[model samples]
Target chain A: MSTVERTPSQWRVYRSYHSPFDPCPPRTRYFNVPPNVLQPFQTSARKQFAPHEALRKGTLWPEYFSPYPPEARGGEAE
Target chain B: MKAIWIYEKKLQYPVRVSKCDPRLAKMLIEQYGGADGELSAALRYLNQRYSIPDKVIGLLTDIGTEEFAHLEMIATMVYKLTKDATPEQLRAAGLADHYVNHSHALFYHDAAGNPWTATYIQAKGDPIADLYEDIAAEEKARATYQWIIDNTDDPDIVDSLRFLREREVVHSLRFREAVEILKEYNHTKKVF
Candidate 1:
């Protein structure tokens, strides 16, 4: 019943990269809001969220402190 | 502990100046020790902080950083104001003195067009004296910002000026707090 067409090349490329990690879970979700709404709808769950959650959501910690060089990590003692 | 140095690492702030207006840029440069007020504030806070006692070191360090931010804000304003300026407007604003020498590049100079010099700042190394001087300097900056805001018709310029003015107020409060802390330290030592 489906009318959508898929090319052989598209299927091959998709199959080639298909691995356990290919369908990794999303880190965040997007919400769609109605244009007519005057005020943003507040989620009750967000209200009681912990401070760490707020920090993770709001702050750019990763950008502020980048990782050290690989050599700086130090090798095992011989 | 050592102080953390922060670099803006951006263009850092840009200002859009029309060909018709150039005086505003010339005036904003005053804060960077350009014509006198700002550069003086930056140099004053930085130099004076070094001599402050350990008890007030944190406060001094914070104020010094704020001074650096103000310097950036002023420089951004100057850049915006001077951007796309015509030769006639620049000459009329007496920016010719700067453009003639620096070629449209911004430099710290006094209101009278003298280049910024280190003699503008004093660091006596006395906490009490330094605190007093800082309080006075903040007031001077606040007044300067107020004047700039009052004189400028541009909303963008006014907005930046107002922000700078509020910062001056905040810095003044912090300096006062530092003074109180120093006084308390003296009191506790006396009691012991």
Candidate 2:
């Protein structure tokens, strides 16, 4: 569920068009964007992730974290 | 060639395969030698760095070295997935061809079984062009990981793939920054 408001959340969402003519049912709504696109040139920040947490998530900064579709923040909705 | 990067026995990210699925292994092998795979990425950046502007050369070296680490991770994933599976199982998974050639061994080949080659990569010698290619490679790798995650049912494999996918995003950003840095260097040269 995307909106007009511009919050600096890590993810940006988009919907795939559902075509009735297609043979199969459309997939769940919303795709998550990689966080890098939002901040084209990175800025210095004091925020950081703990070492273990960084290793697990693959990024030291929380803002760079981009979750998979299955791990998307909220439950899927039309 | 003397220790450009120190060797670390440990994987940058842990890899554990909870199940043995030769089918998934066959697909995952693409990352090992596919045209857009990490090996091509590593060689491309490493070769391109020798000719790029001094300010951006180290960044290329850094990212290039990390790409080797990523190749290791992909190898680990493919090995764990197929390690215990039998010849029959691999055959059933359309890896019969793979096993015949290199039984229970990993080869640098794509999902379709094409051998790795230098043609997959480019070293344009133009810093901006090379950086742009690096960025494109990163995004393509990210998309490939996402598709693999979509295909597989195993949570463990998906978890590792997600980490690798995120790394691509970070690499892409760094390359983009390198492009900007090169631009600034050109602007400064004109003023001087």
Candidate 3:
């Protein structure tokens, strides 16, 4: 006992941490425009051409280019 | 700048393809200007657009894209028709030559299976000439589609063909309008 050397002792401290686990709530729905306030907008755009007139002029050719010819009345068997 | 809007002005026609028969599909594809007409129309519009005057560039570009869509529709019809065709049926349809060469590739072949060639398109660099050619091309497409409808027995195919033929008529009108716009532009410049 007399031959042993003594050393100074240091103390260590520990602390416990906790976090809350609250969940997020659902969001409430909102509308920008009132249901009754919205209305379809109509413009006074002039008619460019009548349907038959446009048809008569062949101006719609690009749209009408068919790839099939008319079917024969009784030629389905061949 | 408004080229997209101009192109969007194209009218759409709904076409129904008959899935039950391969022969009808092959025949209907022919109306898409098969081997020559629809491809030619697409190539012509696209090629001619480059030569269009600076003033009419927007119009030309729009028409070119529309032609591209028509080409797609035509190709779709062709593919649907020949998807499961027998060798014998293909032969009877005179498409054996193409099947042997391409093995079901949806090519720009005529009813007889001839391959597409570039001589189908034209671009003279003159707006007037180009417009005239467009009008003629539209008529040819209409006629061909009409012929296809006449030859096919499927009602579904006929309906689609009729729609396409009507589209050609619409395109012819649009080209005529473009020509009118060009004429007006030239007239104003002449006065200036």
Candidate 4:
């Protein structure tokens, strides 16, 4: 599955409204729903990583990690 | 009898700068000393702990201590990037003012050479207000890391920065949780 399709529920995807009179093309598919919104009180994190992996990711829980690399960001636009 | 931070001999995440790039180092210095920098973050949370609710005091202490580890990581990166760099190289990288003042030594200053100032942080003594500020601070730090990742060519630095940015996300969520915890309390204690 593509990363977009695989994005967890914590990061919700929504459709953007494309207007007819707008000058720029619509970026319809993907925008962020910050993970916190899905969990109001955050009592616990269910899933976790091993010590080595946790150190590498900076979070023991995988759901919270969001990566921003130079390659996939659509250079000069993102 | 009190909370004491046991000395951790290493960074929370490994920090590696592949090659000497004084320019990149100068930019990364912002995280070390800018308004959204780790120093401000560490002090802000730690100072606010005394005034915050007992339920979230441990949360603030844990995140605040971790920020110190991040501060160390940043200092290590800056030192590695500028290691053995010549005065001319430093000047070309727009660190001329820093060089004249610190002479190859790292100083707490932003990418633009603004000295780290106490005005950069606050402790409102209100749990909800303080936690919200903490959340905002995390988002700001995350944005700064993303910008730095965009600007640098070093994969090693990007790797470390990506880790730090994710920690900010987690921290913000924890602060959000802290706010909710505060909200759930009955008003008999006279807390926010």
The number of the candidate with the highest DockQ is: 2
Model 1 over residues B43-112: C-alpha lDDT tens digits?
6776666667777777777667767766777777777667677777788887887887877677777556
Candidate 3 residue B161 Cα shift, in angstroms, is 1.6
Query: What lDDT does each candidate get?
Result: 0.57, 0.81, 0.58, 0.81
TM-score of 2: 0.86
In terms of DockQ, which candidate is stronger, 1 or 3?
3
Which stretches in model 3 have alpha-carbon errors above 4 Å? A1-78, B1-15, B29-36, B189-192
> B155, model 3: CA deviation in Å?
2.0
Classified by CAPRI criteria, candidate 3 counts as: incorrect
Residue lDDT tens for model 3, A1-78: 112222121111222332355354432221111111121111244344457645433232222222233122122211
lDDT of 4 by residue, B59-153 (tens): 98999999999999999999998878999999899888898999979888899999999999999887888888999999899879878887888
Per-residue C-alpha lDDT of model 2 across residues B1-192, encoded as one tens digit per residue: 333679999888888787777788888888889988888888988888778888887887888898899999999998887888888888899999988899999999998999999999888887778888888999888888877887888888888889999899889888888777777874665534
Residues B102-171, candidate 3: write the lDDT tens digits.
Answer: 7788766666555567776777888899888887787677667756765667777566566566666566
Each candidate's DockQ: 0.01, 0.64, 0.09, 0.52
Best by TM-score: 2
Candidate number with the higher DockQ (3 or 4)? 4
Return the candidate ranking by lDDT, descending.
Answer: 4, 2, 3, 1
lDDT of 2 by residue, A16-45 (tens): 676789898865444445777767678886
